[model samples]
Target: MASEPESDAFHEAVPLAELEAEGRALVAVEGVPVALFHHEGEIRAVNNRCPHMGFPLTEGSVDEGVLTCHWHHARFELSCGDTFDPWADDVDTYPTEVREGVVHVNPTPRRSDPPAVHWRERLDDGLEQNLRLVLAKSAVALQDVGVDPAETVETGVLFGTRYREGGWSSGLTILVALANRLDDLDDEDRKRALYQGLTEVTSDCADQPPKFDQEEFAARDVPFERLESWFRENVEVRDADGAERTLRTAVAAGATPEQLTGMLVAAATDHRYLDTGHTFDYVNKATEALDLIGWDHEAAADVLASLVRGLASADRAEERSSWRQPVDLAAMCDETFDRLDDLVAEGEGKEWKRPDGFTDRLHAADPEEVFDALEGAIEDGATVEQLARAVAYAAGRRVALFATNNEFSDWNTVHHTFTFANAVHRAAQRTETTELYRGVFDAAVNVYLDRFLNTPPAPEPSPDPDADPDEELEGLLTCFETQGRVNRAGAHAAHYLDGGGDPERLKAELGSALVREDTGFHTFQAYEAACRQFDLREDAAERRDLLVAAARYLSAHYPTRREREGTFSIAARLLDGERVHGADAGSDAEVATGDD
Candidate 1:
């Protein structure tokens, strides 16, 4: 019986004789139920409830100085009440004393620090150890206490740059981008972004040595025009070092991110979306990240440097003859904007209009018709806001239906296009960037034009309003995980939601199914885009529409062929032939005799 003091707070829990008779006794002291155990002539007291699932510890079995919860079999040391399993946190133990052959417990248990404080300490530990789950838990807990996500991001950014010798990477780029978009997000999203950034930075820096700082570019006085040209020329020539030097030189000369934004955007768009839209998207995201980080000139330089890598390896779709000839796409795009300017001026006093069937036309996947419908809506007093929504919806359709091979890394294709459209939509919420919306719309038209590549076209979605969503969800998960039914998964989700299924539950399940395994970059982008789309859940019909589109896009390029043609068949024949020949003495002779 270990006791601190026989203060007035101590209350008689049970008679020592009764505890010994039953081996354990549950007693209420100051409204707190405590379980007193009599083992080896010693009295020990702990909380009556198991911390893991609230199972009564009084029913737990004590053996070899350990108390085991029968509910989940979680074990704890009775003496100190330390949980053997990490999932079950340590139980609270009360100081007990056998005074006058009676068990007395200090009903008032020792108070632990606040949850936020505890989680913050855990966050520090997680960062130190680069532990993923701990970092994730800490981020969620910190956000629950209304802590700013920027703080967590700063921690990760500092840790990553300090530890990772490779300078900047895609993870860092994305983390920076997420940080830039953090303030605009809801609490859950902010926390998730923080967790993602922390995890990425930690993972990227883990086991890597610190990088030596680069020698400062001495040509700080170089003209901005010349530096800009040098950066583009270096990126064009795949001179990564030269490109980085140019960016660093420009930054060293006191170039603000706004001042340098034009150069990066120019380099990106100068070559018609350097990598099937991904280059432009990356530039945009990196710019957004720079804006969010707020005045870290070194990080700006690092971001631009990493972007040059993408610029170098990116397959420029602009260079392709398919994009250039017959259409004069630039002229058409300019003409649409010119008309848009005229319409905006004409509809100054008129209320913003939404023509019926506008969404249907977009979902029909006819680019020319979509443009026609859009132009009509503009003529009918549609505002820039309306156009933005229309274009965003169109973009979601592309995300739902875009498909391509792994060789070309079509995932990025889908992601870049979706993100580009999404960015345009977000921009629309604040300003009237009509030209940007047109650009997004024009790029989306190209996505529609490339639909033939989606061999074994996506199956049409049947809107079963009276179906069992839970049953559909089961199949959706199975197909998504095992059979690569990406599009079908979206369709199933739509069906599940239409059948009165819980949106959050389905979203969670969809998220789990999509990311249950190790996924590629495109998968992550697509899912993130999906989450953004789902978050705008005003209408269930629109949600179903978006999901159906996603399913179609995902399913279009199924029965994927990552290997060369006949590779598996040739290997199988060789393996089978060798095994048969080894087992049968004259298998080749029998084949030859049969042929004769």
Candidate 2:
């Protein structure tokens, strides 16, 4: 707000004799719209515009001490402009005094405290009422006051556990998982992660009161094997209490993160890509994030505990043909891992070359051809870096190839695969790349699992490759932000080629877009992997092929429900509050309802 001027501090409006009792008047004092009300033997003034909407408050009905905006029926106290409805923010009140018969109003309202304090209050109101806008403001403003982002995370976690029914969910899982990764990220990314964590939890718990779950851990000294059995049984039965107790018991008994991870993965894999692979991915990522932040088993106990419900909620894959069919995919994955080991050994003395066709073979997607290419690349002396890149791209392809026409909850199918592959790719950075091959093999299994989804694969690039590179690149980016459809991306590629845009430039553009549109941890990992591959400045054609794979993968899996009018609207509104963006429409789905 601008400072009050020395001159014309108070502007006189209508006289008291001319004003009618129990009436509202709209008057402009020093160019500020003020709603003056003659009610209950005194005069009160507030901003003319309703806080809920831009509707004029002068047109609203006033009774006793309350003023109601007719537009949304949001009520505010007459003098203070404090709203009764949480969604509707408080309207600014102006100081007013009547000297004799003349009405005077101060255009510049008095400020009693800093914005941080006010925003904090608004945040509390938001949390209490589940107002997303206020939630966003408070989260952002809290940091401005030197408040730690972790506090926000803790706040969100408490809110989620205390309010949401059915206990933990993917939403809460996302929150807890991101909380573990906060320290490893840059300042900006940390803020985003924190904001995402808080918003996800609030969104998850919104509209639902907490359902208390009884805690029941085994009291007897149980063997590790017995406890694992008991834990799996409890998880299978959706017994959150028993599972939590079993997990805590293991942690307390000096269980390694690896052991806990093994147990979770066992429960997860027992379901054959549980929840379209999200359960295992969440389990894996949460565990990995703990490792990245140097958090021990004690810290990770809660992380896994939060996921018990999500794991229990999943429909197990043991009954599917993917597991029980003539060709056992799970066993095949084991064999592939074995082959990967032998191939890594075989490539020891061989000179390395970039496997340009690796992604192509994965896309061409004859299971045998792709498998052979994986082994052949190793024989041709593919470096750990090259192999890791190819495997991660292949993982992304699994996500892209997923059918989008399924039920809303099924969208996690693609999301889990992509994010899981991303998690593996990132984890490979710190650990030896050889171990991450299991991730490659797992991604391959998912590719095989989802083969039925992509009845028709992604279309190849245009034969006549001649187009304006700049314009085509722009079109492609526009399509990513707007439509995010496969056909549109293909068309843009064709136009770019038709206009003489080379594969190299197109890849660079795609990489830049991936970096810009990085939605979360997995997206960031994909972009980072691309940067590392390209930072070497080798393999132009290989880079182009990889970019094409990315384009195809993105095409297959874009315009996602994740970016729909739901949660994005809250984010958008927050940005709008900063005057940096515009408002968006609300979503039919609740916040954190199947939101990744």
Candidate 3:
């Protein structure tokens, strides 16, 4: 409700009541559009055009004693027309006052003042001096944090201040300085502050008119050799724990991969701290470098996969805690897949060249083929849960294809496999199905079950017992296998045996496999199958033997499953001679027998 400023010139005044009736009213005064507002029982006037984007504030609304621009919704307090949000510049307030029943407005002409050149020069000089002082202090700080400060001071001072003053020739020099001294700041707050200040200076220059050559800022030489030497002199690689700690510290300090690569490579070549006899630490360093430098999607993905491979030979406990857990790798792979999918979906006819050599063979293949390979790898040695995610990816891709083509009926075998499983799961609670859907579901499940039962043996354990179990597991699981061929074999088995093609031969072979003593649970499952399929009575002797084996196996190895009451039987049988009888024994009797 505050009035505008007072001035010497006299002008016709409108009544406060009248102005209130005409809220957000506009009028031309001295060839300028002035907007009038009445709030809190007071009159005010301001320039009609918004300071930002020049929208007409007069056409806006007066809400809660504030004038809001309708175009972009920038709001200003009507009392003083001050921009409540600093992001928008404040509105120009005009002089207005009430005299008796009328409002008076100042009509004095406002003079334009050019920016003071002397002031600008003073600001520039002070800013440059301040930057130079900061750079000198920062150089000393860098040295204290184990970083080389030999050439960084001059470069940082010159480039950082010059860039702030619209001098492009020195911006690139600042970037180089930043990259070189990145590993020097041990304190996160100090490091972040330095980067923030540098970024602010650069951004200010970038926002200004192009007064300097942009190319100069892009051409500054990065001192990779100096950085490498510094790392070699400072970073110690005595063990994996030390390596991880050092690498994490470097990442926190903002070290770039390009700058840290030579040092990492040297460490690996020297076999320093080669825990698990692999280069996982070096791989992790490379990955950290890439992340710090904001590498492109493909480059990041390549580095991630390389890290995974390096850690692939670690123990299960190590693998879970290592940088290459399935969750981590799956996330990276998913991101890569999404990027690839987006590129394809754009239909720009741009083909991304796949990575070179055997490591990238799967990248160039079709999505389904890639998924099949992933599944095969999981079946052989990879975690089932991880492989299930890949299957999900394939399923998602199939759906996307169907959406694009509208040809759901023309799916390939692989597509049908995923689709049918998903559809059957969704339809399990329902009763209706078309012949095609039913057939596909039945065929897919039969094929999967047959393949599952006939899965090949897992990889052989390493001869060295002291070898890290996680690494062994990773090696076994990540080794590429042909899932498509396995699936085909499964389908063939299902067709000839479960599908009534050669029941007699199937029974003979299965029976022989079932009787093999080393077959373990497979034999018990086969017997259960026979009982269910052929209506055979349970063989007491066979059941007894199976129970005994199961109990022994559970007692010796199933630590994860030991909490189950069923598992207690194994221990009970070994400790107590009394056999458990029928199911309805009294609790007291059961407890007495259990104690015995």
Candidate 4:
């Protein structure tokens, strides 16, 4: 028999005789399955769920003062429930006592600190151990307390930068990409978004050797001009160490964010749309990470050093025949790049009045005509950001109108142009450097070159005023479940946007749809680029186009094997303390698969 305690929290666990005779008992405390142990002349209670996979703890053996789970051999110090195996994590132990021949246990475990504070520490632990469950738990709790999402992003940024000798990685890039799109998602999805990004970053740094620090030159008095030249020179020759040192020196000399951006943007363009424009996009993302993490010398050094490898090792577009054979586009760029400075001087501090119907002209098939159009705009005093935005929108159109007849992999071709244009747009906004004008022109040329991919473009979808927004969105996601639904998916999302549907809901749904699939780095880049460009566009038609581009791209890649997301789901369930295994869970089990 069991007796109740005066405090509601202390539920009568079991009779002293009953618990002692068996040495352990399973009881429900506050509906949480709890395991009670009579060991080492003491009575102890812990949650019956195993911290690793939710195995039944009462069914396991107890020796001395330690409790061992038979499922995974996870050993816990029964008194405090601290696990000897860190991967299992510490279990929650309840306050226990014996009164009047009856055992009593508090359903509410003792707490020495606030959840926000504790989880904040746990976030570091999760990152340290690359433990997805701990990261998910900390993210959920921290978001509940309204902790700024940037703080969590910063943790990943620092960890990612320090652990991988490669410096910045696609992991950090993906993390910052989601961080960029956070506000576009619904409140709850924001937490899930951060968790997803953090998990990727963790996976990136796991088991990798730590990065060695790069010190700046002893003289902080060096001029930015000299350092910029040195940095570009080193990158031009693929000298990674020299480039990193030069960049660190610039940071130490108090280079403004714009100045630093100018250096990378200039170097990225020094090689004719370096690496099919990924070089520029990565520069923009690394710059964005600085926005979330910080721009101080220490933060700058840790994050920016990775770019040396990215830039020094990146494939130069001019080296590829594709840029040369058809249009001699690289030669055309070289001709303009020679006088690029003069052209930039003409455009500085002047208002850009787009020539009539100029947007349509940017995608003109004649490479010469495209160059003339861009030079016309630049010579008319189009600002760098203005040029970037124009080029990005044109690139967006390239994607929005991307043809389905093309082989599936070619989706990346137009995507490359659009995302590169978007990066140039973002970086252009950050600096007044004329160097990005070359980046802008480079993007436009790529867009023009990519026009073939979208030739005889798919008929654009229009808003159906009568269609239900919710149903349309649901159908939009459903498009991913089947094969070759690319164009139809685009139509669904575009129509939903113009039909007075909530953009945030669409974005959240789109984001959820993306994270659900086994997506890759470029997929993330495409999704975020669309969201960002969507934010920058005021034209109703353009907004609709951005949505269409993202939907088409995601549809093209959707319903992946999804094995990766499944892992994250199980980890999330464990963090929520759900019993995933053991007899108490029974044959009928609801598998948890992420933040729902």
Candidate 5:
């Protein structure tokens, strides 16, 4: 076999005599250690470090052109550095030539794919195999080559939506959520966010089978209204296949993005607070993911398909005791929904003015009054986004006013309502549909249902507190080191905003606080929602309040035992080319050899 071509610039490695005497010799080319081997009448140079765990490969045994790592028993071909085990990954290979009795090796590895292409393939492999380390490496590698991180988000969104048979998982939601925040994050956190989202995507697709896609209608003349009607009807009957085909049919009919979103919005709200408002949230996020990456109709269909399954079978909150007992929020919503079209029409072009005491009525105990109040807002010309924002603020109050006496599990109830409301508000921005109005109401009612959580509302932090912003921020982070101080945490975030401190710094700090913890799905949701709501508001008070709510929520759940954090830390250190295994942790991965 002929040797593959390599870069002409070769570094003098070691004398061929020395390499031949020991059968192999490890030499540094620039800063990297390359192992030169004489085997089967050929001299081969490969990266000395095992790609899997960074173990030195020079000590491993080679036979019949195969180099096997003694640690993991992973075998690779010496000539091309292709691994026999997929989990081990391929090692790097360098072209070598004998020059004046010395072995000269090209430091650059001869690869079939460029860095971007190889890392992309590795990313797919990582996703397929649920390998976080490989995913991390790929993230760093791709970014190093100036490839936009959003591309990875796109890759994950497609993979997750296509592979998860049960429909859109929370992993997809996290991916979309983090994608929205990527631009605001710094480099390291950007990578952290990417790793977190992609890792969740990998976990979600693990062992899950791909969905069978439904093609567009053979005839493309079906009207949008008819297809939408067919879609909702099938969804109501829990016929996923029929609903999917109808959805695809609508897409094929050249339905606008708004029309497609309207279809999901209507179906998702058909039941009272479906899946506790998560159904609409996922629909909105799926749409947002499409927004982040330019919508390809086929890709859009795959993303939406995940949501169609959820809409078809999501749990209706009407079935839950809390929504029905004492006060039937479901009935109120039904009455309000019946008149939604007229209300939306009655308010059209009205130039919305926020009614005095509007939010107060929303937070009040009576569901009927709340519906009436929201109806009045629509009637008074409040836009879809306007209504959604007010509703989201109410949800934020649920967390901001959360009573510490409640069980830790109860925190999720407020968290869920707030995140859902924020997601609905985001959807409203994409399309102005009467259906999303139901989501706004659903969120308000959820906040109402959670009223008991704020029975004795934690006092709202005084705006413009007479305190140093720097001290407050430092103190807030310190609380994360200790046990529950949720109320105090909220105050600090408020003070930071009130004191006119750097809003970017506060966001960055809160973001760091979020990722450092061993967290769950809800935490990511809460952080993203708070940041989102903060950005949407122009009022200084509202923005501060949102971050206050976020700080409290994060503090309530901070300081986890961090079992996974250890593994992530190790992977990060390894990526930085640091030794993490033992006393030689300060040094890079290398094999011991006598000085040449």
Candidate 6:
């Protein structure tokens, strides 16, 4: 047989009318394979390259008005080549027309260029060169066609090739030419067109260059100030790439702190860019810009506060788990706090004077209270540990008040109480206080007694359960175990208990010790625990009288009221449980369980 003719390799076009109802034809046009489909009474042709990963559309199947790429099973609208997957770039669309019962492709080759190179591309000569050429051709075409400025910008953006393999200089040159065109029009229209074009270009330039030289670029009659002002006034209200460009432009132009602050506030409030990571950088830059401008102390403080609040809000809403592991909230907070603290410290001691009662209002509004009031708002969300940390930070300043009397002595007491209070608060909120507190208390008591008081000699074998405490207590509890000596041990035991103790016999030992030394707080805590464990309500009034007497005896010695209050508070809670007077009523149930 004669060799087949090379011409036979070319695919013959199917007559438009001859297309089977459910058939597709793969044809070669201009040496490129094209897929043809006849469905829903129309002839559709698409380039064989799949929009996603360039899979061949020819090997794909058409069913129910959609084409599925065989390689990746990506579906597209046969008529428009619009990929159904939003993440997939759209496919090339070719105009198909039927003539004389034959489907004809325009053969001129319809090509879709890449997205436009955003204005930031102007910073790179090679890239800018390609971008300029693309823009130049687009502008000339758009002008010849009499397109509106907005439409012109949009059309060029959609059809322009963003970054050519070599560079984007062509697109930048086109943009510069477009910018020059602005000078020929009347002032108002020219400014408007420039603003519109800048907006469009910047909006498309999501990944901006790290830096730009504003003065040099502005010398080219770009009306950089006018464009920036327009952006600040209008575009900055949204966090689109366009808005980012405007802000960056303003920064480049040396915008004032107030101006930058205003832009940031607008961007933050818009909620459009809130989810985008761009806002963080903007806030940080704006903060630095404010410092450079020598903003009024109050204004700077306010701006810093706003940034912190915005960051906090974002942190809460963000899916931190999906974010990079070990998110460092403390590091971020520390940095922010340092900045604000420095500003405050250097402000000539000029306190941030707000309207009367403003500080008071903020101080009075505890987040815990807000959380309680809006309990339903949380749904089942875990406790906001950051919020708790913020509260602790605010409360830290007040801790000094408890240390005024006897610095070291008071500090130790207050510090210990502070830790206990925080633990109790956390436990109560979690509704695990009873068990957690008891466990912690028991473990602490055991550790302290074993390690501090009852520690065995080194290398001795472990003692049997049947070992007698009489041997350990022999000398310590001899006749010298008078009321005073016994009272001393009782006081020590009370110290351990208040720190988180659970020894049952510690109270009797403490009482006897206190009878000798008369350590008032020790007697108080010991008697309190004893009353609770042994149901000493019958002697409750008598014990209270005795505690008063002991308080009087120690009045001339150790720091009295301050130390007594914590001990007494803990004692009251232990003794009366829910019936305790003046102890945190809300904590009564937890205290009743004797956990903490």
Best by TM-score: 5
Please, what are the lDDT tens digits per residue for candidate 4 over residues 463-524?
67777787889889899999889889998997787678998788878998877676888899
Residue 287 lDDT, candidate 4, scale 0-100: 92
lDDT of 2: 0.60
**lDDT score for candidate 4 against the true structure:** 0.82
What are the clash counts of all predictions, listed in order? Answer: 4, 11, 9, 1, 0, 40
Q: Candidate 6: where is the Cα deviation over 4 Å?
A: 1-22, 97-103, 108-255, 258-282, 286-596
Q: Which of the two candidates, 5 or 6, achieves a greater TM-score against the reference?
A: 5
What's the CA error at residue 467 for candidate 4, in Å? 3.9
- Residue 567's lDDT in candidate 1: 27
User: Which should have the higher lDDT, number 2 or number 5?
Assistant: 5
TM-score per candidate, chains pooled: 0.54, 0.65, 0.24, 0.91, 0.94, 0.24
Query: By descending TM-score, how would the candidates be arranged?
Result: 5, 4, 2, 1, 6, 3
Worst 10-residue lDDT window for candidate 2 reads: 587-596
lDDT of 5 at 218: 88
Best by lDDT: 5
Q: Which of candidates 1 and 2 is the stronger one according to TM-score?
A: 2
* lDDT score for residue 373 of model 5: 87
Q: Which regions of candidate 1 deviate over 4 angstroms?
A: 1-150, 157-169, 172-197, 203-270, 283-315, 325-388, 399-412, 430-438, 453-457, 469-475, 478-481, 485-488, 512-516, 536-540, 549-596
Q: Number of clashing pairs, model 3?
A: 9
| lDDT score for residue 439 of model 5 | 84
| lDDT (Cα) of model 1 | 0.61
lDDT (Cα, tens digit) per residue for candidate 2, span 481-594: 665465567567656756667655665555444323324444433333333343433544444434444564455444444432233344434333311211523221111122
Residue-wise C-alpha lDDT for candidate 5, range 243-300, written one tens digit per residue: 9988887776778888988898889878887887778889888899888776664687
Candidate 5 has its poorest 10 consecutive residues by lDDT at 587-596
Q: Model 1, 1-596: lDDT tens per residue?
A: 23355577688777888888999987766656687898876788887766555556888999989999988898999988888876555677888877898888997555356767766766766666776656666777777777667666655655555566655555564566556545445555565666666666677777888754444488778888888888889878877677777787887788766557666665654444455566666665556555555557456566555566577667766456655565555555556766777866666667655666765675544556767776666666666556756666656665554443433455455456666565545444444434444544545556555444344344546778997988878867666544556656666777887788886666555444332233334544555555566576576666776666544444433333423112222223322232122344322223323321
